[model samples]
Target: MSEKRSFLLQKQNDAGKLNQSKLLKAEENARLLVTLQKKKKEVEQLRLQYKLLQAEQSAANKRIDALKQKLAEKARCKEAPRVHPINPPCLETDACLRQTAIAYLKARKQGNASALSRHFAPDCNYQYANNREVPNEMVMNNIRELWEKWPQRSYRLLKVAYRDNHVELIYIYKYADQRNHSIQGYAKEKWETNSAGQIIHWREELHPGTSPAESAGYRLVPLNIK
Candidate 1:
């Protein structure tokens, strides 16, 4: 009977050991599950933070685009030509029309083709001396060529006449080359303005005896001032 009792005690001890191992394994599994859940929470938070960052970046880009558009508008406004407040439209009165003509001459004297072209209509007719009517582009090209030939030149207004939309400008045009060869002559320019005050027709006639070295009584002093 004592031997049987001893065997039973050994079996009971083995069962207790098995039960202990199973409990330890279960605890270890619970710990692993908790760690996995923590890692998942961290990954979710990171994803949410990434989404927020993307949204902020998108908003910033929109703001940047808006600022760029505003800057472009400001630049355009600055570049546009200024209009007189008193005369909202161009060429309202005879005085205003005369001013426009003078402005054209000033732009020509300054050798600013862009400014000069602003005074003309898109399909303006141009004639020089007895030449046939040509497009304004040819006239612009001629002006540029003239400027190249005579870098120093001046057009002094003598008188102005107006008839309806037509304006007659009497001026003394003097020009000199780099070699000091100069010429001066009286010229007449007839300009017709459209309702918009832009020159739609232009004709110029230089009087006789205006050729180089033929201008009467005009003298070029020596460059040496000593």
Candidate 2:
């Protein structure tokens, strides 16, 4: 009987140990679950913060782009330094017309006399203020004579007007050395271009007392200094 009671006691002790181990495992599982839930919450908060950062960065980029565009527009306005807008016959032909006119003037100032012919039509006519119409054959000679009289001649274009096939210019003419005389005058010129963009007709209207004579006594045109 005592042996049987001892065996019963050992079996009861084993059952109690098993029950205690099961309880410990259950407590550990609960602790792990709580920790996992907290970790998940932290992960979700981090994701939300990341989304907010992306949105803010996008807005900043848009603002930078807008500022850059504004600066570019200001730069464009500063670069254009024209006093008056030039209206060409056709938008597509504006550049060519202006380029040709500039090149012609540059050639004349540089004393490239032979280059002048290429800018004019075959049957060009030049009329002076005295109603003297110089024929095509005498154009180069007249130009050479004018250049010889005032070797230091220069022109400042004051105003320019343009039409479909015509251009009118007002200019201030200056010759620093005409027998030690500083001569200046105003002149108006009109140019008529052919369909091929070659100058076919030209007219000159020099202000009174502006014409120079070859003689030493008439080295300067008599006019008020003003």
Question: Which candidate leads the pack in lDDT?
Answer: 1
Error of 2 at 22 (Å): 99
Candidate 2 on 82-103: residue-level lDDT in tens? 6542334453444455456566
The C-alpha stretches of model 2 lying farther than 4 A from their native spots are 1-88, 129-135, 208-226
Cα lDDT tens digits for candidate 1, 26-112: 999999999999999999999999999999999999999999999999999999998554223223444565566577778878899
The TM-score values for the models, in the order shown, are: 0.48, 0.46
Q: Which ten residues in a row have the lowest lDDT in candidate 2?
A: 217-226
Alpha-carbon lDDT, every model: 0.73, 0.67
Clashing pairs in 2: none
